[model samples]
Target: MIWNENIECASRDSMSQLQTERLIRTVKRVYHDVPYYRKKMQEVGLVPEDIRTLDDLVKLPFTTKTDLRDNYPFGTFAVPMSEIVRIHASSGTTGRPTVVGYTRNDIAMWAENVTRSLCMAGVTKNDLVQVAYGYGLFTGGLGLHYGTENLGASVIPISGGNTQKQIQLLQDFGSTVICCTPSYVLHIAEVLEEMKIDASSLKLRVGIFGAEPWSENMRRDIEKKLKIKAIDIYGLSEVMGPGVSCECTHQAGMHINEDHFIPEIINPETLLPVEPGEVGELVFSTITKEGIPLLRYRTRDLTRLIYDKCECGRTLVRMEKCKGRSDDMLIIRGVNVFPSQIESVLLEMSETEPHYLIFVEREGNLDTVKVQVEVQEQFFSDEIKELQNLTKKIKYKLESTLGISVTVQLVEPKTIERSAGKAKRVIDNRKI
Candidate 1:
């Protein structure tokens, strides 16, 4: 993987030209090294020579989550296991876990992407980073860790548990930066408030959060609560891990490391590339990776792509906050919806907490979605009718925002699960 630190600032025409060259190389590599990709390409009448330019990428076959699952273990690995240095995988909640292999160069490439993300977030060697994301097969912890290290910053690898110890380290070590999921950060803020800890007194300055979809409203809440700048980071286990792109200090949008990874927005139904600034499924192709290289891997995440230069002087392409996944999208009574939409609306209501669940079901040939909300006493009035009115208000707000009617069931505080880690927002029962 070539880590040209200046690629982000490279001219647009030059970046596209570089992408074309890398695409040609990646196409040849996948077609020659991986049998699965070769078969798929053959089915689509695609050959290495067929992909001569960036536009020719559409001629290649699109990869999917199912492809990774069908390949299982290392079936899709471009290199032998001996050459691979690291392994990461999806949670496989829907089916068998889709695993990814990384060679030394691949690992270096991933670290470089993460490092670039940190640089975009204004993290430097002088900052003390506290990584609160989970370790293990999950890539959040180590991804951010290696990136921070790559930037020559001091990292405290407090991998996601023991909130008190995490705080103590933040206070005692004077950690200046934090990384974790946005919901987990909010939970930590709550704990800090409970323990009467002064977050303003803490040395924390910025937080990079990802692994799940969030909204700008949520960002404002997190920044206000923690008294730190909250930036968004995005990645998936399929492509690499957390650090494919990140928000700049300007907070415009996440800048994709276009030199290493090629991003395309494609229509979900047709699997064809969409025009810039249009919403569609995100696809990625690893250019500088050596291990388990992917070509046109369809990341179900939905977002728009921007080609304008960022205020930070990086000319790399930018992507908006992921709206939802193509597969994760739900249709009820001709209404299209997403879990993140429900979560966003829930977070806005003063009567509610971040803890909630979306129950999707098929009742009598009709799709049903019930949003379970936790009501707080702060907004919960003494009169039962007033509390009922508050519930209606929440439902009306959600309906207006989501453009779909949802049954909002208000429950007692702490009745639903509370986590110092990632919050599970959906209890989907409609299994395909």
Candidate 2:
């Protein structure tokens, strides 16, 4: 099942040695080519020589999204513009989009990483893959696109949106493997239900989902509805897209592609490395990237690392599914809560649908959190007492889990808008 046995199953000592060598070369390249990196290194009173072994990585300055923005379009690029073959960017909702460039070699490496990920997810050359992630500036679509092609699989290249057409293509093309965001896949499943389409008639067997955090409950719901193996894939546009890590058929933690990208877990508050198997901020250092090699880039995702060999026989380190993001944490009435916690609670309830939204608003001197969730059609009834009981049950569970009182409103099915991309899970209107 491993795509590259030599690298994927390499011993810890050998992998560490390879990472150290690549890390040294990356440091040298960035220190000499990128003035911003050189200045950052000089500010820390260090040079490329300071990073000899993997242990020395702690001495290097950490890269952040702000650093990428300050550099703008091309300042972060290590190679010359002539050598750069491709460019991709983030949505830039907060500010300027974080731009990423890829040289020809970088593109090939990216494809290899994703290809390895696809193989780990049980995809093969014989399976027809449908890529529903948005293409172009967004890295998800094309990242999976080229990887599927590189794996020698037939690719539909359907991109995102057009739900009806997507369903038709899924049935007609006989796509055995689907790649897209988890939420989008759920939306597609909803559409199939609306059309009264039998999931048994479809050829889908495996689904590779990523680009957003999803709960384990949601994964089970997806698998049950679609009748496909729901696999969690992790990646960020800033760190070479969706190929950074993926789950094998084992369905344990996602395996990090340590050969190309070095994975690290550090306490976000202290900015120090956490003990192995402890939850902390996930960081990555792109060692083999040619165009935009990054050193110790903070991903802001919260997860733990498992260095033990996997049951699937791969020796690569695995990262537990992300709990939430450090910046995405919401403090309601002086109590910190994550949307995933609420999601976990809702998904556990059979009466409620997976789609829900959290609305945080300031009411006078107090902040109120209101959760609007969809109730299954079969559960919807005209009895006021029954509705009140359902609401109370949801509110009690959420308060017990989140440790904060919340207003639970049970709406009808399909009340909340579904997305073909990352779902908007939270809307905070408090002007803090």
lDDT winner among the candidates?
2
What's the TM-score of every candidate structure?
Answer: 0.77, 0.78
Candidate 1 lDDT, tens digit per residue, 161-225?
68899889988999999998776787789889999998999999999988877678879988998
- Which residue runs does candidate 2 get wrong by more than 4 Å? 329-432
Residue-by-residue lDDT tens digits, candidate 2, 262-352 = 9889999999999878999999999999889899999889999998999999999999998877776565532346677787777787744
Any runs in candidate 1 off by more than 4 Å, and if so which? 1-5, 329-432
Error of 2 at 63 (Å): 0.5
